[model samples]
Every structure is written in C-alpha cells, then in structure tokens.
Target: MASSDLVRRIVLLVVLCVSGGAMAQTGQDTSLVERGRYLATAADCVACHTTDPAKPFAGGVSIPTPFGQIVAPNITPDPDTGIGKWTDEEFYRAMHEGVGRNGENLYPAFPYDAFTKLSREDVLAIKAYLFSLPAMSQDNPVSELGFPFNQRWILSGWKLLNLRKGEMKPEPAQDDAWNRGAYLVEALAHCGTCHTPRDFSMGSDESRKFGGGAVGSWQAYNITPDPVSGIGDWSDDELVEYMRTGMVAGKGGAAGGMGEAVEHSLSKLPEQDLRDIVTYLRAQKPVRDPADEKPRHGWGAPSEDVSAFRGDETGDDPDGRAIFYGACSSCHGMAGAGTDDGEFPPLFRNTVVGARQANNLVMAILEGVHRTVDGETVSMEAFEHKLTSAEVAAVSNYVLKTYGNPAGATVDAAMVDELRRNAGEQPLVAKLAMPGLIIGVIVILALVFWLLTRRRRRSLR
Candidate 1:
C-alpha cells in the first residue's frame, strides 16, 4: 500500500479508540444518573419543580416566601431553557456548594440549606434524574419579589449569612433507623423548611430551631417536645396514623401548602422510612414555651367571667350576623342544631361551651372547621382576621347559650382581645406538634455543624 493510504488507516484507528473511550464514560454517567433519579424522588423534586403536567421538571411553581414570592425554575436537560449543557462539576457546585451552573449564587428558597447535607454522589444522582427527564421548551417567568429582594446579588449576601455546605453524618448513638431518618429529614425531606423558625433576617433561627416562623400568608408552628404546645402529647400510634392518613382528632387536617406536600411527596414515602422519621423525631430535645401550651380558650378554670354578653344586646351588629349566616350556618345550621357533618358535634355541645375556658372555642372561631371536601375530608381555613373579635365572641356565645347547653359561659369583647394576643404569639413548638415525628430530626440535624461538613473550611460560618 502507498504511504498516504497507511497513514489514513492509522488515523481511522485513533478515531475508533477515542470513540470507544467516550462510550465508556457515557455508560458510567448513565448509571450515576439512575441513582440520582431515586434520590430526587425521595427529595420530592416534582412537588415544586413541575407545575404543568405537559412539561414535567419545567419549574414555574410559585412558592410563597417571607420576603416575597419565589418561582422555581425548569431543571430539565433543555439546552436553551434548562440545565442541559451543565457539566457534572457545575451540578455539584449547585447542590453541594449552593452555586448556579454559571457560578452565580442560588437563592435559599430552593432549600439548599437542608440539601447541603447531601453527599456529592447523592447530588449527582439527583442531577442524573433531572437530566433524564424530557426537556421542556417553555420558559418560566422570573420571581415576583420586591425591589431589593429581586436583585440576584442580594442572594449571595443572604447565602453568606445562612448557607452551609455538607453531607449528613450518621449518629453513632442512634440505631440505623434513626440515622436513616436523620438523613432523610436533613437532606431530602427538609421538614424544617416549614417547621423551623426564621430570624428577622429570614435565616433559620439556630437558637430557636424548630420554634416556628411566619411565611407569607401562613405561619409555621413549633415542633419541639413541649407537652402542652408540642408533640409530647401525641402518641406514637397517633403520629403514625396522621402520617398514614393525614387526619388528627381535634387539631385539624392538612390544608393549603401542607395538603399539597402530603399528596405529592409524603404519600410516596416508604413505610419503613416514615417509621424512621418518627423514631428520630421522638428522640429530640423538648422546648418549654409556655405561651404555646395554653389552650385556645381558658374554658374550665375559674377565670374571669366572660358571660356578660350572651347575644345581640343592641341587635345592631349586622356584620356579625352576616358572618354567621355565610360561614357558620351549614353544619351549625340556622338554629345551631348539629347536622350530619360527622358527629357535627353541636357547637354548644358538651364541655366546649360549659368549660370555664373559652380558648378552645376561640381557636375554633379563628381557625375555621374542616370536614369532607371533594369527597375527601380536608382541613379548612382559619378566619381570625376575616371577622372582628366581637363578631367571634357574639357568634360563639350565641352557639353556646342557644343551641347546646345553658351551662355555657358567654364570650365578651375583653375576652376576644386576650384570645387574639395569645393566638398571635403562637410558637413553632405548637405547629410542629401536630405533624409527623420526623419534624424533630430535621430541626436538630441542621444544628450539627461539624458532622455535616467534612472539611472545616467547607462549613457555613
């Protein structure tokens, strides 16, 4: 053969060798991607990432934040619209380091604080899952935060204040179940996102921990071990039942964002994983916030008499009557007779009215009742702000004295002021009390600074 022909043959061989090496790398990448898929599922990536059924992972879900509204972004492998061209290192930086593919900082609205506990390998697994999804062409609108918050540079400063980088550490003292739960809660489940309180600066209050925080229109309750205000009152069986079925006897059912979380993410958790979460939470430190422990109404105790005003004294409170007619008349009925709304438990029925305490009744008025909706029993909205305190007192007293029993004490204007003050000061310990036990693990796991970040310099200051 000629020299030119021989040289061409050699070049072809070199090309084949390069092609073979590329294929091998691709195979390893595919395996990692598969692992990431599982991790993302456990993390409930779909809950916030995908808003439209036609475009999965094309994030545009509007999440309410304390400062403003945040819109999640499309994470598919779309070249123009998603993270399609991002390198593995870029993905790692985003997850473990809280940086974007372009080297800019990410907003903590993504819950990277909890995700920081995720191993690099685990984060890559999630990236793999994200890349495997069908790319969405639709572009999402930017967030609707106010002026200063809308600036991306501000997020970097926020990260400096709050962001941490690390992986979850196995607690040696705890069993495998607790360890697994800690991992899930701290890394994937991120239960503290809602249960934990935030400082005025909007960072998680490490001091108060899962003490509670107000987010947009909703208030996150405390999940500590306080008996009167926290889960100390909840039995293990009751906790399990709530996680499994989303119902608690007196507290209330899940509604709003909570209901969505239960349906999209929690319902998919494995039974063993759920149990682990419960175990880890049950083992947490208890909080002692007396403000959270007090009952909704000070019913049974021999406190000041609120029975001075029974019904319409002047008969001029039109708004009060209208509120009662529009909202409370269904199961409560025109005559306040208990209907078939489950044991529609008469409003004036039993100790709720007769007890010296009026807190139980006040909470009921502020936080409206919930029953079956769309054939499913769902939690309803609390209308504390919707109606005036006198309206609440008037309607409450009307139900108590007229419908169920005469032994019930009447509610008054002064009593309304006291109830509002108490309700407004609700602690995080109280909110976390009603949910599953995993809440505690999430709160505490965030506190383990040394164990989480393997490298000292890698830690969040």
Candidate 2:
C-alpha cells in the first residue's frame, strides 16, 4: 500500500481505539456523524425530506405519487414535530419494517422496502447522523390522498406481500468491490425504487429488474446490459462519467429524479465507488424490450430545413419552428448543433428527445436543467411560464421530428396540460381506490342500518 494510505489507516485506528469504549456504551459516536452524513447523502435523504435548505431535514416536501401527494415528515431532532423522541429501536423498526414511532403503518412512499435491506448498525448510524443535526420544529403537512389511499391500514397487506427484510449478503465468489457496490446499489442508493418496473400492487417487479421504470414526469430508462434497450452500448467510462457529471454528451443526461440523484448523491460518491457500481451493473442479466429496435439515445440527426424560417410575420397560430428559433436556437444552434465543448448539448441523440415517450422532453422544457458538480454547473432555463401549453407541445413535436425520434411526437397540447396538472402514469391502486372506497362505504352504511333496525324492533317487542 502507498505510504499515505498506511498513514490514514493508522490515524483512523488510533481514533477508534481512543473512542471505541464510549462508542460501544452510547451506541453512537458524535465523531462518527461524518460517516452518517455520507450514508445519508448516499441515500439522498435530503432530496425528498428537505423543502427549505435553511431548515434542513425539517421535511414538508411534497412527494407526488399516482395515488396522491405524500408530504415527507420532519426528521430533525425536534421532540414535538420531529423524530427527537424516537428510540434507536423505533427508528430501526421504521426503517426495517415500515412502522412509524406510534406503530402506524408508514407509506411505501418512504421506500422502506429498500431500507429493510440495511443492517441495524447502518440504520442506527443514519439515525445518529439525523439526530446530530440541529432540531427544528416543523409541522408535517397531511398527505393529500383520495379515499382508501388516505387510510393507512392497507399498508399492512401491502407490506406482507412485498416487504423482504434482511441485510444484503455478500456473494462469496464476487470481489470486495462488487460486494460493496451491491450493498450501495440495493440498500443505500435504492436504485430499483425508481429504475425497476412496478408490479400490480405498485411494488418493484424483480423479474424485470432494471428494465426501466417511471419517476414523476420522467421515464427512468433501462440500465441493464441490453444493447438496444439498455446501457450495454455505453462504455464503463461513460457510465462513471455520467454518474459523476450528470451528462455524457451524445448519450444521456440526467433530469428529474435522476438529475437530483446525480446532483446530490451519485456525483458526490468516490470515483472508486462509482466504478464498483458500474461493475455490479455490468454483471446484471440483460433485459431486452422488443420495443427498442434502436437505442433511446441512438436516434436523431441535425436539421437541414432552413426554408421554414424564411417567413417574416408569424400568424395567430402557434408555430413550433418560430418558437424554437425564438427561444432555443441561441444555445442550441439553428442546425441543432450545441457548443463544441457540449456545455449545451446538441438536440440530436439526446436521451430526453429520443425517448420512447415525449413526457421527459416536455418536462425538460417545463423544468429545465440544472446539475452542479465538480465546481461546474450545467443549466437550462425553464419555459413553463414563458410558453403556452400549445406552444410547448408544438416545439416538442417539432424537435422530435426534426432532431429526434419521430415516434416521440406523441405530445399534444392536451397531454401537456395534463402533465402540468398531474405528472405520472396512474398506478393500479390509484385506478381502483375510488371504486373500492365507494363499495366499502356502501357496505358499512348498509350494515349500520340493518343493526339499527334490528335493535329498534327488539326494543319495541
């Protein structure tokens, strides 16, 4: 080993030796909060939990699902409004069994299924780290769920079917790097919570693991080793670069939840850890989708049509070409070629534009792009307020045909309007919740009336 590595190890050993007894007694080391902080970042806890950076982890951020919006609760150490009173065991149960402090069934929205894979030591460490933060009292917003969704009892059934609690076991045959990567990917990172397709009950489908799933307003594309449908076409370097930098030009760029993960979690990870992740991903079974005849990022070409721009005064009707020229052509060239350095990516072959669906492309227009890492930031301005729904659809369609996959031209003004309203595909539970609630209510009312009538009749007799 290098001299620097030896020195670092020695220093760590000395510190542990001095503090080990206290650590064992308290089951926490304040000095160890740094480790907890790193793990929390790996879990990307702040992304969902913190709405305001000033009051970190005083959660009220709305996490939108097809069923409804779940407001993340405050995790800061405030006794009244947060988890300050929770024992380490209580916190562990919440993580390991999806049960809250008061023994309430917590929502799957907290992603406890993945957390269940975390070891008790790690869970406590995360808690210790959270507790180490400044306690801030912030009342959690009640979840805005419809009908039966607002009921928590159903989560018990959901858990029985889907929850698998266990620490990640190392594959004996694999190297240490691969094992570490597996734990990081499965437990801390919980990539499957977003990247894997969901079953009928809205739990992840392990059969089609890493086959591609959807986050709100964006599709999490396949990352398995399938050439056409997944990242098999990408080099190891490309994958690592994308994880660290959030964009590997001419291939894919992160946006939405993926962007958040990259910016907050993946980008901060050590290079070796990123490589290990790539290594583990490389070993996964390649899942191919018949729909992908070509790569999602493989389609598209620079536009050659200059004739459409010759007209001077635009009419009342929304013109996509005119809109794109007015707004987009400055950063991305008239020919759709970005900068030589790819600071502004070329439209052609962008993963967002050439996706199987146009949802992400539309979202990108509305949300824009801003990912910062390594002291550099890549940005795009959001046009949601600036552009009308019709104009957004028009421009999206125009980009699709001229510079991206023509099949992605499915966006219309109505679809854009709907996306603005609610930005996710309806899950099975969401589809059933309304009818289920109505039937349940009717049954309860009938039972109550029958009981009341019988009691009155008996009393009269």
Candidate 3:
C-alpha cells in the first residue's frame, strides 16, 4: 500500500472511534434524561408548575395560601425567565433546603419540605430532566400577600419549626414493595400536603395523617384504613381503580384538586406504583371521624318525585326543576340515574352530592367537572358565567335534596357566593387564628431585644 493511502486509513479509524465514543455518551445522557422525566412525573411537578397545557412547565399558576396568592414561577429552561440559568447545585438547594438561587427562602407552597426527603441523586435527576426541556420565556406574576405575610423572611422562622430537612431512609423491617410505597407516598407524592390537616404553623398534622382535610372549595377526604372516614372498606382493586380512573361506581368520583391529581398524575402512574400506594395507605392507622360514620356515597336517599317536577320555563324566574331539566337533565337524567355507560355518573350514591358539606356540590355546579381518563376527555361546562349565584344555589340545593344528602339542603345563595369568591383559595392557619398570635410574639420579642440592648448600652456607658 502507498504511504499516503495508509495515513488516510489511520485518519478514518480515528474519526470512527471518536464518533463511537460521542454516540455512547449521547446514549448515557438520554437514559439519565428519561429517568429524570419519570421522577418528575412521580413528583407531579407539572400539576403545580404548568397551568397551560400548550405551554408546559412555563408556570403561571396562582397558588392561594393563608398569606396570599403565590404564583408558580416558570420552570422551563428559558435563560431570562425560567430556571435555565440555574446551576445543578442551585436546583438541588431549592429542592433540599427550600432556598432559591439568590439565597432567599422559598415559601412552603413549593412543597420543598416533603421534597427535602428526596435523595440528592433523585433531585439532580429532576433538574436534569427539567433542563432537557425546550426553553420557554414566561414571566410569572409576583405574589400578592398581606402585611407581615408578604415578608418572605418570615418563612425562615416558619422553616425552623416545620422543615424536616433530610432524605428518607427505607425501613429495614418492611418488604421492598412496602418500602417503595412508603417512599412514594411520603416523599414523591406528598399526599399529606393536601390530605392532612395543618397546624398553626401550616405544617402537616402528623397525628391526623390522611384523616381528611379541606383544600379550598374541595375536600381531600381521608385515605387511611379507617372504615368510617377513610378507605378501610375499599378493596385493593377498588383503590387501584379509583387511583387510575378517579372513579369507582357506587362509591365516588374525584373533582377539583383530587380530580386534577388523577388527571395529571396518578392516572398516568404505573400499575405497580398504584398498587404500592394502596398497600401503604391500607397499612395506615385508622383515624375515624364520627361525622363520617358512613362513606359520602352511602348517604342521601334518592328522590321519588324528581321525574314529575318540571317547572315553567317561560316564567321570569325559573325554578330549580326547570333549570335542571333544561341544563343538567340531558346528561344526568330526570331521576339522576346518569348515563348507563357510566360516562356521566349517577348523582344518587355519588360522593360529592352525598358529602355532609355542600361545598363540592355547589362548586361542581358552578365550575363543572373536566377530567381526562384513558385517552378520553370528560367535561362538564362551567356554569359560573351562565347562572346567577342564586340560581346555582337553587340548583345545588335541588340536587342535594332530590338525589344527595339531605343535610346539604341548607345551602343558600350567600354560601354559593362565598364559595365562588374563594373558589381555588387554600385555607391558611395564619389567616384563621395565627396572625394575631404571630404579631403578639413578634412584639414581645422586639420589646425584650430593646431592653437587652438598652441594658448593654447603659453598662458600656
């Protein structure tokens, strides 16, 4: 062979080797990115971060707390507006310490308290997946809060009391499945964030873990193994079905935050993960509330005369019967039997309607249900713009009386108006009774500090 041809062959070999190495590196990166994507899904990051489906991760979600409305910031990789400029360490700190890139304390609304239990490897993986996304330039609205609540510095004090900053360790005594379930429920899913009642500091009430709590207009019902207030009566199959479809016939269906969760997170989870969650939930200590002696679906007798109650549509003020017939009867029959195919659920034996509190039923009428399951979209058009508050109250009361819990029959127009106004807002303990206490404590601390400084100055003089 000629010397020139031999040299060219060597060059070709070197180029091939370099190309192969680059391909191997690319494959490894892709695997990590995919793993990150799965972890993010498990965490349900998109539920809070993405408000607009068209602009996923370009956050503009308004999260209401006792302090005020804190908007979720963009998590996309946009250099100017999103986390694109964030280093891996910064992202990890935000997850593990609830601190921002600028060293400012983040509000607990981010759920970093639970996220702190995540392994450093998992946290970094989530960051890696987020960084792999296309950059989106979306500016989030500034949080609008009242007085001392607006002060982010207050979170530092709050964190000192509530933040359990550490990664979760697997229980050695438990089987691998149980351990996995425990981690998913406690760390990744953070179900207690909604289900557990809050203390004065707005931390999850560990004593009442999964013992039902209110989330804005919706109720995050008990998931413990209690037969009365919780899911003790539910079979593993029933629990799995509910998690996957957000509904189980003769039981109840999910709406509001729970519905959003089913639609965006739980429904898409792997079947084994769903089973694991169920297993963990079933093992929880039953914390029964007397008020929930029976499941929501078990309350409320069906109205016998619903079919005969058509009203005068031509009248100036149509009665609930007329409104029901005109607007809701087509999907939910005159007898509230719902569609036979189960696409439109029966109002009778429905958990939302049968619940002791009428808030969910009222909100459903006003906001309507919109969820997707198994590639099919389920929607109920919102009536907020269409019906007057009084009209909504009337219709809701009618449904409650005719097909649901009679206790809910007392809902009035004023109640509907209140629910409408505070639609998606979260209840803050500080707003409830802590504000005055917090102020008083601050005042006492300030006075004590002032006296100490004065004494020190006098001694120096």
Candidate 1: minimum summed lDDT over ten consecutive residues — where?
Answer: 296-305
Summed over model 3, clashes come to 0
Report the lDDT tens digits of candidate 1 across residue range 388-456.
887887767655544433333467777777655442333343344335346666767866765666566
lDDT of 2 by residue, 29-62 (tens): 7646877888999999999999998999999999
TM-score of 1: 0.65
Per-residue alpha-carbon lDDT of candidate 3 for residues 437-457, written as tens digits (9 for 90 to 100): 778999999999999999999
- Per-candidate alpha-carbon RMSD to the true structure: 13.6, 7.1, 4.0
Which candidate, 1 or 2, has the higher TM-score?
2
Point out where model 3 deviates above 4 Å: 1-13, 306-322, 423-461
Model 3 lDDT-worst window of ten: 301-310
TM-score of every candidate relative to the true structure: 0.65, 0.89, 0.89
Q: Lowest lDDT 10-mer window, candidate 2? A: 304-313
